[model samples]
Target: MSQGKRTSQGKRTSRGIRTSQGIRGGLLRRHRDFRLLWCGETAGKFGASVSGVAMPLVAVSTLHASTFEVGLLSAAAWAPWLIIGLPVGAWVDRLRRRPIMLTAAAVSLVLFAGVPVAARFDRLSIELLLAVALLTGTAAVFFQTAYSAYLPSILEPADQPEGNAKLHGSASAAQIAGLGSGGLIAQMAGAVNGMFAHASTFLVSLLCLAGIRHREPRAAMTGPRSSSLVGEVREGLRLIAHDRWLRTLTLFGAASNLALMGYQSIQVVFLVRTVGLAPGPVGALIAATGAGGVAGAFAARRVAVRIGTARATLLFELGLSVFALLIPLTVGGAGVLLFVVGGFCVSAGVVAGNIIKASFQQRYCPPELLGRLTASTAFLSYGTIPLGALLGGALGTALGIRTAMAITTAGIPLAALILFFSPIRRCRDLPTSRRPTPDSTRPPAPDGEPALPRP
Candidate 1:
């Protein structure tokens, strides 16, 4: 009888090990809906990365655009965050997120395809490029806002870290492929024709989105039909302002983006002109440096588990970013590795920090307010990007590209000071929910979900 019992226990233990191994293989292998979402999002990121390299190449090589004009082109791509970011968040919360994403993807497809068509007709101009970038930027704002809200609906809180890590990791890998191809495409064909590649990726994204099996239910209406959009926008802003964690993260994101974009806006010009690299080598170098994002994504969950999310954020965002100062030291031949090392560290830190923040926000924020919270924080953070681009242009023109790179890179580490000075410094793990007072009247979450805390 004792031997039989031992045999039975051993069989069960073996089965459990197999089950756990299957799960460890990841969501991409088992979860169909998330798999589709990941594929679509990764494709979209790949196209965007290609465009990032191709667009500037077209301006600099074909149009002979000056330093400031190149910066302005980068700025146009993000300016929509300042213009339409706030309202889009409220609108995303009020509608089905998937349709919004689909529509945005379609619009992007059309807009990107138009660029090549214009080039074929000998009608491509800097103004046309700027307009295309601006419109595409508008589409991106809607798609991104909806996508952030949609992910939480499909994923349980426990699975969110894995989901975020997978998505971010795959996106990083796609970016590497795209950036390298963008330069090669420009080198082999004309830079103007590269838009075809950008347009096609959106088609892949569109098809994947259309094939998603899980449908999101209609968003819950939180207020009267007559509620003003302005009021809703204000509510999002107030939530970020009042929540210490949200406030600190948002502020840090804004400051950090300002610095990040500042250097990125002029990096191509720096590499081509100051570093004297050809267009092909420039793209290859950028793509090589971006590999760090994959590493960061792979390690984020483990790092958070070992060191706590709050400490991981500090280490990733601040500690790794100190290498930014190496970029300006880059020159020809072996010296170019300096830029690669600096860029790799910065990319790793930023990607890891973003994964941590995404998981934190999805779990911490009230479900109904997630859209608004996403939008409000993005508005503040991404809004600085255009200004940063312009600053890079202005500084490059005034001081020099090398000097501008130095200044902007220094700010990457400095931005993390906000995190150190704020409530985050005292915490081990990020708070999962706000503690309600004794007399609180907030209702409990239905269906055995965690309780919704006060914002």
Candidate 2:
């Protein structure tokens, strides 16, 4: 390799970079496996979001489900996470993960499709709807748990941030489409049509799962075959509990998610009832919030590279805390100028938090326990969102909507304080030059996965 040749090759690489950016789709070309998984999972997530709104909307508008039953519907999705997440993680460690993921996806499609069919026949009972939601969620937990375990297995260590950003981007885009399409279908197709729309989304997801061509490494270790499930679960817990840093990050993530949901729960209602926006504009305003999230997803890796992921997280969180605190005082404009700015800040904060957490978990946790770690962590992180929603709703009813909005702002400060006390806060931003090294005592990443440093 002469210097002239080396310089020529470097120039060509730079040209490739410019070409990819012009298209704004580098991850797909850069990492093929990740792209397939992301694309295949689309139907699953798209359908999930559609029914996420449709089922509850059905419960409320058609069945006149009380606040309690709607609460029940929401509860069904997360209950498994809290009750069975750790146990399930342990169980997953004992089995081949790919089959579990595929099966769960297939089952979820059927469960989601059934809701619409029952409704079209004019038999959408509250119990039936709730039952469908529960079963669908049950399948979703397995699908999701399996996927998280599957991630570190597939991605190169250097690729996880970009891979994760791709996943987040796809999910955000899917939800944007799902929610918007769901509303239109419900309006024009009647409530029954909404159910059909939900069903089609699920069917599409089923097809995507069929196209995924990758498999996990078979020799993948799973402790002794004779090990008890309970023992495995406890082992997973012990790993996190003993690690001062992991425990701190876990607690911080869980608390942040709860506060996020608390604010969201009250936001639209407060906008409609208190901010004086119509229902039509109110919903669009919420979608604007999603757009903020999409922007954040796009910005995640670049910002992490620039400021380092840790400091960027603090900057984003603190910025949002200030924004959340100001909500009560500032939401008076007729158009979306205020809400748009606030929503973008809040959503960007969430994207940064999630990206940091994902990168941290991938870097630190060994492959064998990844399942347990993710499930246990999700049990708290995802579980808290709904509780926050419930609490925020109650606060709005009791303290008046404006006051509830103001109080929920406390969650931002609370999350920052929690992080401040945690050791992870002191650690330099992840995705920096400190590359991940295999902790030989801990398990390897999936498939003899090699560890490499990200930029």
Candidate 3:
């Protein structure tokens, strides 16, 4: 072959390689709609994190709320998942998700801003705080349900893991920033003023959402509408109950959340009253611990690829949770490192596990049923959060704060037992597709009983 001809072929190959690499650049850079969505979601997460610290601080410092009341405050934020989760899912399936998300964001902005307004009027009572939390939480429920279903429409099946990882990673980073900022803002001006920061983020999110170019196609109505809301909800529940993989993950998630929320509900009180930390330090410490989530998010895709998703789930969710016991051992000065380390592990584990779960659901479930699937599973998993918060508050009241922390932390690792006893333990990778059940099959292994056979 002629040397010039060989060189020309090499140049063609090199140009092809360059084009491929350019296409493979970060999802945020390559996809405009997804980037907008990511920005909106991350901004919203930052706001929530700020309020997570500020709201409780307001209750403790300004309103002089008791320990149980603080726990109830936390519970109020998650209680909507129990009350309206099912109906919300069915509704999301039927509607254009972006509008629902926009409305929810608008509602949240008003609600958070109302806090400082009420404070200015000398009407900032614990009762009012609870109402704000409750209302914001309700908005969150709608936003989240719609958001989950809408995501698949924007990204291809292959790109989902990267998308989930980027979203989760940025969210973790935003949480760290927000938590730290919440403390400083509280110390400098006051906790009440921090709500302004929280409210402002939603405005950013709203603008980002508005900037997105892609519009989801309206959900197609097929045939005569035979299913009532209740019937649709039951279909979602039945899907989870019948699918062993879904059932295992959902059960484990519920158990894990219970334990997680249990300790988290009283962490502010423990740090303030027991660990002898100021409000600023409390937020900073929590922010520091959240760095683990950032690590988890960055590592999730690689870890899953290296170890398989199912095994990665166990390692992330179960193995890493063992460090949670260290949080209860925290004290003044250098002993605070114990809490940091423990919280880091727990955060990393949860985030990584979530990435795996999110990718799985987007890939495994039918697009039409994704909304219901997300809602039903979340209803069970997140529903336990309020119960856990109340339990933590009750335990802290009955036992010492330290004792309550220890008890709750123990449950974190123990909750993984739900995974161990189910089908997840026997497989390496979680199945990418669920097997179809015949239309005539009996309603799956009634609720709690395992349904699908081992992969």
Candidate 4:
């Protein structure tokens, strides 16, 4: 045989061996790096979940914060996304993702751990709690932005969907466990101890992340060496603005989040005040919503395959989320079940939609632009969170909690119509590529179901 033919055959055999290995073992069992990353993320989510419950409890129970103050605390945590999201994207793209994650995790650990110490010293207050929440939240913005762009680098294009599913499933599972346990911890060990538990999870996450072996591709040097940060940030914004699909999804995400947060900001208040539930059961009920998320994560791929990705998105977003209106119908005894059911469907749809959307963006965006793309989208999507929190708080204080909830919950279905009326509804699959600019030489994005002509 010729030398060239022999070399080609060897390469093919090596490729076949790797493919066979992947098939024989699932991602958790086979891919060492992925397993580590998954574990770290799961641990981080667990910590965040504990803190989510603990923080509000501290505000309401210990400090006797009013409804608007509670909502303000929630808003403080997310407000950084709108304030600094754009610049962080450019920064993330310029640096490695893992180190950013590690740094963020460490910062969170110290901040949360300090909460208990401050409580012991009789120095804890609502303002201090809000500060910690805001700083930790700021760290999360960078961590999440980097993490979104990092995943595609670790997993191949073919494994991306499964990777996303597993990550989402584990995150939901972690949240369930955290919420379920957080209430008990607060009851038995005190809420300060719950914050300590939250601190510990970030430690585990830090250790797990420290073990990952994959190094990101070095930032590309082909562009002008002295590019301005503003220019880089603008590029991300422009790409989203010009791309119809990204624009549509961004708008839909913003609207959906706004509605979701509006109700959520006041949900604990409504449940505690109106439904007359104790803290422990309240956590359990909230945790129940995550059960649907676990289901949604597992079902995302199958649903997309059956209905087509674009249609499935609308189905999940519009069809399932309409159930959100049932939450306000909830009463004490058997009626709280209505809240659980409605929350379940909404949680399921949101998780499934996120899995599909994350995978799609990974496959569709240019590798270099992923960080900025994620940040820009998140900036809009999460930016409304503070506004919603304030709106919900105001409405709750003005019109009563039940009335505020009803109005906000109804907005969930209304937000989904943005997608239905856009190009997403008519197309069976989301387009993989935007129309190429005349001066650009980048390849067409990964082709999913063949492109429909531009709308």
**Whole-model Cα lDDT of every candidate shown, in order:** 0.85, 0.63, 0.86, 0.83
Query: What is candidate 4's lDDT per residue for 380-444, written digit by digit as tens?
Result: 99999988988898999999999999999999999999999987787666644444476232223
lDDT of 1 by residue, 182-260 (tens): 9989889978778899999999999999999777655344444328888889888988886767888999999999999
Q: How many angstroms is residue 275 displaced in model 3 relative to the true structure, after the best TM-score fit? A: 0.6
**Model 4: CA > 4 A from native:** 1-25, 217-226, 434-436, 439-455
Which RMSD values do the candidates have, in order? 7.5, 7.2, 7.8, 5.3
Best by lDDT, which number? 3
lDDT winner, 1 or 4: 1
Name model 3 segments beyond 4 Å from true. Answer: 1-25, 220-226, 437-455
For model 1, the superposed segments whose C-alpha errors exceed 4 Å read 1-25, 221-226, 436-455
Instruction: Give candidate 1's root-mean-square deviation (CA, Å).
Output: 7.5
Which stretch of 10 consecutive residues in model 1 shows the poorest summed lDDT?
1-10
Clashes of 4: 0
Residue-pair clashes, model 2: 2
Clashes of each: 0, 2, 0, 0
Candidate 4, poorest ten consecutive residues by summed lDDT: 1-10
Inter-residue clash pairs, candidate 3? none
